[model samples]
Target: MARDDDTLVQLLTPDGERVDRAVGPDGVEYSVDLTDAEYRGFYRDLVTVRRLDAEATALQRQGELGIWASLLGQEAAQVGSGRALRPQDMVFPTYREHGVLYCRGIDPIMPLSLFRGVDQGAWDPIETRCGMYTIVIGAQTLHATGYAMGIAMDGKVGGDDGEAAIAYFGDGATSQGDVNEAFIWSAVYTAPVVFFCQNNQYAISEPIERQTRVPLYQRAAGFGFPGVRVDGNDVLASYAVTRHALDHARSGQGPTLIEAYTYRMGAHTTSDDPSRYRPPAEAEAWRSRDPIARLAAFLGRQQIADETFFAEVDEQARTEAVRLRERVLTMPDPAPDSIFDNVYPHGSPLVDGERERFNAYRKSFEGSAH
Candidate 1:
């Protein structure tokens, strides 16, 4: 897919029009092919995922979670890119890629364990093909780059069956030295990785303009790779563009930077106050471009989905929310000793010493019980 330079690439519009295939100026055709049912499924995924975020945020407000990162407006950016990945592809996510986690077949409740202050990360990264959410700003870029290098070292490049990795970060992360270093490594080694930056218009309280003078995707050129910016709110566009990038990387084309230009419609997290840093009108503007609403509009206009289908999805989402709420409430508290168990794989004497001390302290209390 050749990217049009003048504007962000878009296949589905906010007003419900679907542009299935369009020829770029270079004579390359960019298209999206999905059955009506598949399109409706995307709509349902968006709704259900958004509902999941909303419910998680509410849980945080009620003290169920210590803090929650709401992926309110950026669902399309995450889900679109995530669903494009093959099963062998591994995902390195920041703390906010809940939509991607859903696409990766991870239990939505798993990350809650981290925020709810129960466990570190409950899922097996190898089994799920999704790494645990990295909380550090841009550290996962390095990890993803190293993983991609390993793929290359293992001779897993230049083929359709080759394994690839992707690192998901925000536009703000582009400024971090770790991200820059990762780019250099990826470019030099021609690592099979995709650097996906969801430029959600804000990096916490700061704006994207504060991060870079040029668009985020263009930065990839400096690292000696191709980059493209897409309409992050247009799920079809995001999915198509990401699929192309991933295929390119898997085929030994090296790294591609995809800047999903979208917006953050809510607070940075449950603990954040976007109202202080953001204006109401700005959010109102993005509101009209809501990802779920746009897809639903297209589905409705095309007669692909009816009121009954929407009703069914809504009901399903409600049931999911209820079940999730119950699961969260009933989450067992982590064992006191479990924390030390995961601190080291081979075992660290410092950690072992601390664990023994704690065990002795507990035994003292037990001795008093006699």
Candidate 2:
């Protein structure tokens, strides 16, 4: 993959140099005008997010979690776009968006419960402005489109206070019927939504090239919306491009598709063995463009953060990781009968009878050691 492709918007180079200006193929000039403090904050977020992912991976290896989908190399893509979202905006995310959930004020421990098989993530979507993690590939796109259409119907767009929706999916999901159907509906209704695709170059074991011949962003043209591809490892570029697209949506310009070109530096999940399908050389090559390292380099070069500051941030991240692990260890398992707790707003006779039978079945093994 050519990192310097003309169509890919990049504001920060892998060498830690800043591109003063970058114009996307869509004719939009993208740049970040963040304060020195904000730049340092972005660095902190990148480091902390990466540390959290590492901790989760370690936990999965230790059997504390059933599985984990890491955002190892995609920290910049998630943090940048996540911070770009307004408080009024809503987000629908696939299972891998732990970084986004962090940005949404969700406790890092919330997702662990889901993976641990104790409970569905119990956070309130309305309160957090983020939906639950959707495990069904591209299905969340359709949900986001429907919610965005509702926003338009409620006359909640086209103003500074207007709301927008963002749906995050992966490159492989573009091939799904639900994703394509979402494009059709959002475009026809001019729904206030942005489709954010982290094109990590693979949909599990399958390379992206196997799914589509053309660039993923180009598909937006067919749906009558603008699409922009950003250097996902460049936090500045990701933030600028996402901010623009989200603003366009809130202003009632309809939907935009943002393809964050990045790489999955880790396995699809703790259960996957990327070594079987991915070339080691490819992973090594991408290591040079690591999102966290690039941002750290930029911070050091610009004097935005000193060695002491970096040390303090690192310590903080380590402390948080330890605390999260402790929390996960102490999480009590829900009662087996709790699964039937939320089946309906009003309990049904059929479900009541089923629960009774289930309890009886459990009592059958009360004193058995088998």
Give one digit per residue, the lDDT tens place, for model 2 in 206-304: 998799988899899999999999999999999999999999999999999999999999999999999999999999999999988898888999998
The model with the greatest lDDT is 2
lDDT of each: 0.88, 0.93
Off by over 4 Å in 2: none
Question: What value does the lDDT take at residue 316 in candidate 2?
Answer: 96
lDDT of 2 at 335: 94
- Report the number of the highest-TM-score candidate: 2
Cα displacement (angstroms), candidate 1, residue 122, comes to 1.0
Per-prediction tally of clashes: 0, 0
